[model samples]
Target: MRIVAIANQKGGVGKTTTAVNLGAALAELGRRVLIIDLDPQANATSSFGLQGVEDISLYEPLLGGALVTEKIFPTQREGLFIVPADLDLAGAEVEIARMPNHLTRLAETLKPLQEDETFDFVFLDCPPSLGILMSNALAAADELLTPIQCEYFALEGLVKIVRLVEQVRDSGANKRLELAGIVMTMFDGRTNLSEQVVAEVRQHFGERVYETVIPRSVRLSEAPSFGKSILEYAPSGAAAQAYRALAREFIQRHSPPAARALEAPEQ
Candidate 1:
């Protein structure tokens, strides 16, 4: 299984949005996907209609010796599951910091899932910070999927996350860690500033940046309130289409050739 951590140090960059919608999109393609909500806000958990599950959540696994699989819950979408998060996760950073082998705790916790091949892909919706939580996610993930907003400070946040990834890899926390891709989010076609930001990011990151850009849409923002992904809430809309394109690109880029060949016959 391929584990991807959707992370960005800066908030309001569509990190949770991408995690929910993209996971749903991948599920639509028949891939078994699991979204692990690591944010204290639990936006991704709420997006899947799983709120008020505070008693048993990611906090249990992060704080106690509870298995992550024990807390996993199925979403409305087929082939998709979620390990929800709660407000209690806010203290996890401090708690995890005090533990032995703290940096690799999440990795150790996820080893069983990795061995079991429970899901085709695992998307970690991380908090918007470079704290212990984010560090743990980086160590657990095989690759980082960063969501960068199309705004003035986009590059600044990107630089910080890139440096963190480098540090994690160089420090031997996760030697196999590499950037899977950078997704441009909250794009506004009408604004020159948004276009300039996308251009600048693409110029710097080149092929590492995804061709599918997530537009700023009211439907996209409204989906989470109704506890749905854009694919379920606005499947025929532009936002859903964008995420679908992103999933297609993601599969093409990440899936092995032999795997693609096997899927093609079924398709």
Candidate 2:
């Protein structure tokens, strides 16, 4: 199994949205996907129609109260699962900072899950900040996927995250952690600014940037309010189709050979 931290210190960049919809899209394709909503806001939790019920989040697990696996809750999707978060998670950060090997706490907490390989992919939906939770996530992930919005200052935020990944590796937190992919979100087809941003980012990152750019659509923005993913709420819309295409490209690039062999073309 692979653990991917979907993070961006810059807010409104589609990090949580990507985690919810992209994870749902992969589960729709028969992949067992687990999302750990590391953000205290619990946006991912609400995105799936779940309330951030007390004692059901990673807050307890991170603080050494309960097993993280015990917190897993199934969503409406057959194979998609999540460990929701609550406002209490905001306090876990302050407490975790005072603990030993503080940075590796998440990694240690996730060791058994990683060994179990229960899911094909584990997506850690990080908060839009360079806080303890994000640091812990960076230390535990095999890969970092940053969702960058198509706007001014996009590259600035991308640079900070890239440096953070390097620091995570250099500090012996997780040497294997790599910036695996850059997802461009909120792409407005009618705007030259959006096109320009994508072209500029491509020029620098090349293939590291996925070709499937998520479009700016009302449907995409509205899905989370209804506690659904774009694939479920707007399957025929451009944003949904874009995410589905992204899942295909991502699987081809990152999935094991055996998993790849099982992949079928999109319907």
Candidate 3:
């Protein structure tokens, strides 16, 4: 399985939204996708309509005793599954810090699934901070998918995350970790500021930025409150179509040969 961590230290950059909706879009394309909500707020978990399942959350496995697979819960989408999280995860940083080989806890927890091929793709919704949780995710992930907001401060946040990714790779925690792509979110074509931000990010990152930018939409923001992805909540909306296009582009760029083989027959 290809493990991709969707993270951005800046809040409201559409990190959780991408993890939830992109996973749904990928699932719609016939890939079994698993989303692991590592954020204390658990917004990604709730996005899938899995609220009130606090008893079994990612907190248990992060403590290093529970099996990661056992925490998996089915979501409303058939091929999309999730490992929920809750407020209890807020204390995990302190607990994980005291453990031996602390940064590797999550990686070890997920090793079994990597071997078994439990899901074709696993997306981790990391916390919005440079803390233990984020470090653990960087250590475990094969690739990083950062979502940058189309705002004035977008480059500042992106630089910090890019530096962190470099440190994680240099520290030997996960040398194979690389950037999958950068996505610009909340884009407004009508706003000169948004267009300028996208242009600046593209100039800096070049081809690393995705061409399918996520536009600001009422429907996208409302989907999470209704406990559904954009695809299920408003399939015909612009945001839904944007995510669908992203899924296809993402697969073409990142899908492994085995996964591509599966898609070939369908095409």
Per-residue error for 62 in candidate 1, Å, reads: 2.3
lDDT of 3 by residue, 1-267 (tens): 899999988887899999998999999999999999999888898887777786677787878668889999998889999999988888888899999989988898898798887699999999898889989999999999999999998889888888888999999999988876999999998989999999999999998999999999999989998998999899998999999999998888776788878778563
Arranged by lDDT, best first: 2, 1, 3
What ranking emerges by TM-score with the best candidate at the front? 2, 1, 3
Candidate 3 Cα outliers beyond 4 Å, as residue runs: 256-267
Determine which window of 10 residues in candidate 2 has minimal summed lDDT: 258-267
Greater lDDT among 2 and 3 belongs to: 2
Q: List clash counts for every candidate, in order.
A: 0, 0, 0
Candidate 1 accuracy as lDDT: 0.90
Candidate 2 residues 1-267, lDDT tens each? 999999888887899999999999999888999999999899999998897488789998898888889999999899999999999999999999999889998988887797786899999999998999999999999999999999988888878888888898999989999998999999999989999999999998889999999999999889988988888898898999999999988889886787877775566
Model 1 root mean square deviation, Cα atoms: 2.5
Writing each residue's lDDT as its tens digit, candidate 1 over 1-267 gives 998999988888899999999999999999999999999989899887888886767777776568888989999999999999888888878888999999998888787788787799999999988888899999999999999989898888888888988999999999999887999998999999999999999998999999999999999999999999998898899999999999999998887898878767563
Error of 3 at 21 (Å): 0.4
